[model samples]
Target: MYDVVIIGGGPAGQSAALFTSKGQLKTLLLDNEKGLTQRALIRNHYGADDVPGGELVAVGRKQAEKFGTEFNKANVTNVIKKDEGFTIETEEGDTYEGKQIILATGANSKLAETIGLNTKPSSEPYVKHVVDVDAAGRTNIEGIWAAGTAAGVSVHTIITSGDGAKVAVNLLSDLKGERYVDHDAL
Candidate 1:
């Protein structure tokens, strides 16, 4: 079983994997190529003068991979709550289990509802629906989280990426049984 299973492969999901795997948590990142990252042409993200959204996601995935996050190409069909944590089912009939799960499934994504997350009509004009999350991306169900636009944040690349990092840190801290500070020091 992995420490965390992250759904989605956009900025948010990649950012979560970067921190969780670096924090000593075994991570599995699953992607189905549905995210809008590939189509984004970004420039407003801090420190990123100009970059393609897909390139940013690629770099983040590589960075996470360097820290030992497992990457998989699969279409996830369901997240089932189990005693050992959660069982992730893929369209290919493969299943994985993890101690925790992060749903970074992006905006207008409906995967959260399958796992019984509390969802509401999205207040954002462009978003049709969003999972309800606390400040740290916790959904109504324990051991499950939703981040990025999937958790009802602005779909801007920067916001979604930062939200991913924030949610990752929180989940890592919970797993560590203490607060985890992934601080950069000179």
Candidate 2:
């Protein structure tokens, strides 16, 4: 079973994978290739200006892969909670087990709804609904989390990315039984 299974491949999902994998978690990121980020032309993201949304996603996936996050192109169909974790089924007829789940499917809560996660009307413009999550990104169900626009954060690439990282840190801390921090020094 993977330590964490992240759904979606947008900035939020990629950012979470970067941290979780780097922290030594067996991370798996599944993308359906249907996020809004793929079609964006971002110019306000910090540190990267005038970057195509697709390029940003590509680079982020590469970064997460560098840290050992497994990447899969699959459309998740269902998530069944098991005794210890969850069983994820893909539309391609594949299955994966993960001890924890992070839903980063931007602006789409259909999967979350199928899993019986609580949701509320989204505050973000243009978003109809979002998974209900606490400050730490935990959903009503334990071991399940949400981040990015799906978690009611702004759709801006920068904000969603940071929210993803924050959720990762929280998950790491919960697993480690202590505060988890990652800092690189030159």
Number of the predicted model whose TM-score against the real structure is largest = 2
Clashes of 2: 0
Give the whole-model CA lDDT for all candidates, comma-separated: 0.89, 0.96
Q: Would you estimate the TM-scores of all the predictions?
A: 0.96, 0.99
lDDT of 2 by residue, 33-133 (tens): 98999999999999997999999999999999999999999999888999999999999999999999999999998999999999999988889999999
Q: Which number leads on lDDT?
A: 2
Per-residue lDDT value at 153 in model 2: 95
lDDT of 1 by residue, 1-95 (tens): 99999999998999999999999999999999768888889989898879988888888888999999999999998999987799999999999
* Candidate 1 overall lDDT versus native: 0.89
RMSD of 2: 0.6
- Which parts of model 1 are misplaced by more than 4 Å? none
For residue 148, give model 1's deviation from the true position in Å.
0.4
Once fitted onto the true fold, the runs of candidate 2 whose alpha carbons sit more than 4 angstroms away are none
Which residue pairs collide in model 1, if any? none
Every model: Cα RMSD to truth: 1.1, 0.6
